[model samples]
Target: MADNTAAKIEADASEIITSPRVEVGTRGVNRVDTVYASIMDAMSNGEFPESGRLPTETELAQRFGVSRPTVREALSRLRLDGLIASRRGSGSFVLRRPDRNIKRFAPIESLADVQRCFAYRIALESAAAGLAAELRTPRDLDEIARALEHLDRVREQGTLGVDEDLQFHLAIVRASQNIFFVTALEMVGDQMRVAMQLSRSLSLERSKVRREVVQAEHREIVNAIDKGSSVEAAEAMRLHLGNARRRLFEGPQSE
Candidate 1:
């Protein structure tokens, strides 16, 4: 059973970002401003507006009067936060709506938003993975693996694997096939996005070094449910989330 995948919304993240008209901090002046504006505009109207296909790098650059790199950087921020998805050689697309939870955030206060969101999400999603094992389909396995492959690439390349990372989690929830399961997953999507974005500086390899170990745990849970080991599956999920909360939420403070 898989435990990931959020519902899809049709809209472009770039079409609606907002501009504050000034430089913020250590980041570059105009580009960051433009990117942030675009992002905010998009978020202001909701993460994606239904009017257009998710804008391309070139299109965004042209719209903001910045380089494609600037747009890419901005998109990268959204990517880690689970705001956008890209299909190789095709283009990026906005999925879910960025509800008021993310939209109503205060100017300076949004930084911690991600952490809070993830703290909540970890609890919901870890349990979902376990449930999926018993509720998933063979087709679900294929979908989950595809996301996993993308995650592996991000780990190896030592860059943000935001989209892939979210995909993996989303697949798990989808596999669970429980409406409540999926609803729980959506409830935390924005926060999960924030946590993932904030943690981008963390080394994917170093941070996710326990890939095989974590994966082994996943397999246990998966196999348990595949074989109808409900107790085992549920326990596996409990343990998985317990570890994640300790490391991500209550871990030793760093700056």
Candidate 2:
């Protein structure tokens, strides 16, 4: 009986190893999202039963052909979504299967999709900025400043700085200290990255003047937040997003 049990464990491990691999760095999909999707697929198929321990980070890394850090990031997102729980000295365990009805932002594949993404951002981020202005602490300010500095440095180098731009916006969202806002942003992270990439690409084609204008707008938002003027912060964010939307749809003439 013990020999049969040992063989069954080995077979299960082999089945996991033979599972389909996640392709990292795919366009329109981030590494964490890829890993998360793969794990969720496994769960949906009952390959990972509830209350059953998941593969260790090392095992998942090897199986998925990704770095352990990538696996860890995927696991962190899973924990945040309440699909899994981790215990000290033990591996992560499945909690509940993912809800298929959860609304997720689709990839931004066209100009229309880009406009839609910006519309969502304008609504979500403008409110987040106002709340952040009223609720932010010194630590939040420091984080926002650091992200802005990174963005400025990248701009000075004449790079589009899509990642830096995303970081700046994410820092502001974090400053709001609202879990719902943060989670909402996190759910659409890939779409947001794509939108940022396209927006920056368009701005790059214009001139340095356009880039400087964006930087000025960012500074305005930060200043309002630092001053604790919630109304000003919201308006600043709204104006910035509105300008971005115009630039995206109406071209450089709108600038």
Please report, in order, the local distance difference test score of every candidate based on alpha carbons: 0.55, 0.74
How well is each residue in 37-156 modelled by candidate 2, as lDDT tens digits? 778667645699767999999999988888888888778656644568999999899877543222122222243345446657777787788889989999999999999899889778
How does residue 31 of candidate 2 score in lDDT? 62
Writing each residue's lDDT as its tens digit, candidate 1 over 1-255 gives 122222100111121133223333446344554574456457546555522347788987787777776677666555544556678987877644343333233332353344335435545665566567667888887787677667656666767766666677778788878888788777777766655553443323233544445456555655665665545665666565545433332112211
Cα TM-score per model: 0.46, 0.56
Structure candidate 2, residue pairs in collision:
none
Task: Give residue 202's lDDT in candidate 2 (0 to 100).
Answer: 64
Counted clashes in each candidate structure? 24, 0
